[model samples]
Target: MAFVAMGVYGTLSAPVRPLTHGWTLFFFVFNTAPIIPMLGVFAALYATAATRAEREMEKEYQRAENLLLNILPEPIAARLKDDPHLIADEHPSVSVLFADIVNFTETSGRLTPPEIVQTLNAAFSRFDTLVEKHGCEKIKTIGDAYMVVAGLPEPREDHAQAMVSLALDMIDAAQEINESGQFPFSMRIGISSGPVVAGVIGERKFAYDLWGDTVNVASRMESHGRPGIVQITEATRGHLGDEVQIDPLGDVEIKGKGRMRTYTVSRGFAP
Candidate 1:
């Protein structure tokens, strides 16, 4: 249409020229016609590139979000992303479980460094799965010891019961790993229920951890517990109803706390 308009205009204003009108129309069409399509092509290319870049950015953001959630709890991670402040909370009633791989130190001495790490990873990975299954938070792993908690950042009425179920599953998982001949070891688990201050610490590594006497006692329970048994503090045992079976370990000497009676999970989940 532009070429036709230019042709008619050039002919009407030809000024009696011979080939000038035709040349003028040809010049306009030759130069201007290609440019419009070229501009459209460039615009299309830019739009496609921009859309692709946006999708890539979104994917990258999602990957970062998943990594953050893996490091911290979901609610805590969301809060950190929004406010980057110090994340801390105190829960009056929660169950903390600490499980240590039996004879890991001695076993590591006989194996190479890679072998030791692989063994620990395999065992802890299984424990991580169980943590997800029981709706608990795995705080961190200190050497061969794994720490997990139930009832907060979201509180539940039966935190101790959940921990007991998790502990029982962990024992069976460790046994399965041992039976596979990948790493032969047992787990000594301890549970304590009480108040705890949980938060995300360390600017560089950013570890989500717990602090309080309850955390301390839970660690002690794991350290002093016998392998292949799930030990629980009297407080934790009290939280469990008749649905779970527990046997008293009697009054035992705890390092920080005086003689406190503890119990062990006698059987797996009843129902």
Candidate 2:
């Protein structure tokens, strides 16, 4: 319409005036028409790139969140996110369970490094599932040893029972793995229920761990325990009901702590 109007005006005024207005309008459109589409193309490209970048950033954030959750408990992770300060808590009653593969060092000697890792990974991964099933928190695995706790981060009345159930399930899982003939191994597990000071340590590689006498006792229970059996402290035994069957292992000498009565769960109670 502008071009038509300009053409008419130019024709009508050609005898009296110059056609400067028409030429100016034509030159203006000619100079800017290509640039208009170029600007739209540039804007679309920028928007697409921004959306892609945003999605990539979101995916990376989710991956980091999953990694954090895998390392720390859900509650602890949330707290750490809210406050960067040190995270520590005292739990008067909680059950700690530690399990070590029997004769793992000897077994590893026969197998290659990759085989050792594969076997441990397969076994611990199964135990991880059982921990979740029993509503327990798996602390960290040190080589062939697996450590877990119950009634922490969120307290529950039956912490000992949960640990017992988890131990039984883990034993069964190990047996199944052995039966498969893929990785044959036995596990010695120990449980201790008492007060423990739990906290997050380390800045670069964060670790959530437990301390106090209870932790030490739990470790001793596993170290001194018989292969393919679950040994527990008297404190932990007190928490169990009659429905679960337990056998007296008599009094055992635990390092750091004098003689303490320990028992083993022989049978009964299936996970």
Residue pairs that clash (backbone atoms under 3 angstroms), model 2: none
| Candidate 1 weakest ten by summed lDDT | 11-20
Candidate 1 C-alpha error for residue 258, in Å = 1.0
Largest lDDT belongs to which candidate?
2
TM-score of each: 0.89, 0.89
**lDDT for every model?**
0.89, 0.91
Per candidate, the number of residue pairs that clash is: 0, 0
